[model samples]
Target: MGQKSGGYDLNLFANPPNCNFVCSVCHGVLKRPVRLTCSHIFCKNCILQWLARQKTCPCCRKQVKRRSLVYVNKLRKAIGRLEVKCKNAEAGCLATCPLAHRRRHQDSCPFEQMACPNDGCSMRVQRWALAEHRRYCQHSAQWHCPLGWLQ
Candidate 1:
């Protein structure tokens, strides 16, 4: 089975969400909800991707066309207002905010993972530890040029 996508994890919700807010495709909180002519709702990306493979509603199996998809703004807003834990919770970030603000929180979250900047390094370190990781990176100038030829 294809990995479910385009929705927040159910475990991220601070409280249980309404069944209406769950996407049938991903079985998680809807990200960008879209309604089909069949009256079934799914995350926008999930439905579109599914349509690309099979042009029918996964739930009702109704024949669906791309033009028949409609964005459900009110439902989207409702889902957005639901509280959710930070995606970096596992990385020691304890912040929680509305689902709508999750991206904003992640942008500044100290525990957010970031790619190493050193040209030859491929490590992913948390935002707060990036500087320290950079200083000790194996690709750093000091490690690559111990003789100080480049310094």
Candidate 2:
């Protein structure tokens, strides 16, 4: 699935956003959206890259200039207020945080899975449980067997 800037699952919204909140170029949720003189909105990076190649707005094909782009503060604030599910929801995370803070929670969520650090270990464990796994991982160089020969 595409990663949404606000971590929101667009399908969960009561009224799914229409064109106003979607980027014409990427056809996804807008991230750091900016508006053009033609009153069309697009993700800043998408429009800037498009402008570099052509001088017309992607939707209306109207003449536009890079300098005419302006941040859509109202839309930005609205997106920030949206409630989003944790990115690790499929991994059994049940917490729902505001869009603005979803990234922070996802970064440290107890349910976030991570690969084992041991060279030969292929285990994937939750971030919070990595330390415990590390202690017992036989593949880890730091883990010494009870017998002296295995050290």
Candidate 3:
């Protein structure tokens, strides 16, 4: 909720979301939406930041206050049910997950990025490819000793 950006990228969604689910301020899918006195909804952070500069609704220019804003739980649940593409989609990940489960999918995503373990190797490779990468890495130990120690 403390995210600098108030919402999600629209393009991340598997299908276009309803217009009401979009924040008029940041122009993205509403995240933690809050409804104003004027019946307009905006992302919580977007409205709060707007109130900081001007105490008027961005949609209808109606006078509003921080105390008048209401958290919209139903809207939040609906948005969470929407499907989204994986952040690593371009990295050969073909997973589409519920918005609420995005973090869970990322946690186990085989294509998730990981830095090389070898010293002096600055390469970043997917988790599924790390073993192959480590085997060929120039910075890795050259050979294994008979006593099972790296030589």
Candidate 2: residue pairs that collide: none
Using TM-score as the measure, the top candidate is 3
Ranking of all predicted structures according to lDDT, beginning with the best and ending with the worst: 3, 1, 2
RMSD of each: 4.1, 4.2, 3.7
What lDDT is obtained when candidate 3 is compared to the true structure? 0.90
Instruction: Please say which candidate is ahead in TM-score: 1 or 2.
Output: 2
Model 3 Cα lDDT, one tens digit per residue, 1-151: 3356679989899999999898989989999999998999999988898899999999889899799999999999999999999999998899999999999999989999999988899999999999888877778877444466675
Lowest-sum lDDT 10-residue window in model 2 = 1-10
lDDT of each structure? 0.86, 0.78, 0.90
Residue runs of model 2 more than 4 Å from their true location after superposition: 1-15, 115-123, 139-151
Better of 1 and 2 by lDDT: 1
Candidate 3 segments whose C-alpha is farther than 4 A from its true place: 1-4, 141-151
TM-score of each: 0.71, 0.74, 0.86
TM-score, cand. 2: 0.74
Candidate 2 lDDT, 1-151, residue by residue in tens: 2533332346544346655677767776677889999999888888887889999998899999889899998998877776777777788888887677887988889999999988989999999899988877899886865564455
Model 1: runs farther than 4 Å from truth? Answer: 1-6, 48-66, 135-138, 141-151
Per candidate, the number of residue pairs that clash is 0, 0, 0
- 16-114: candidate 1 lDDT, tens digit per residue: 999988888778888788899989999988898899999988998999999989999999888888899998888788999998889999999999999
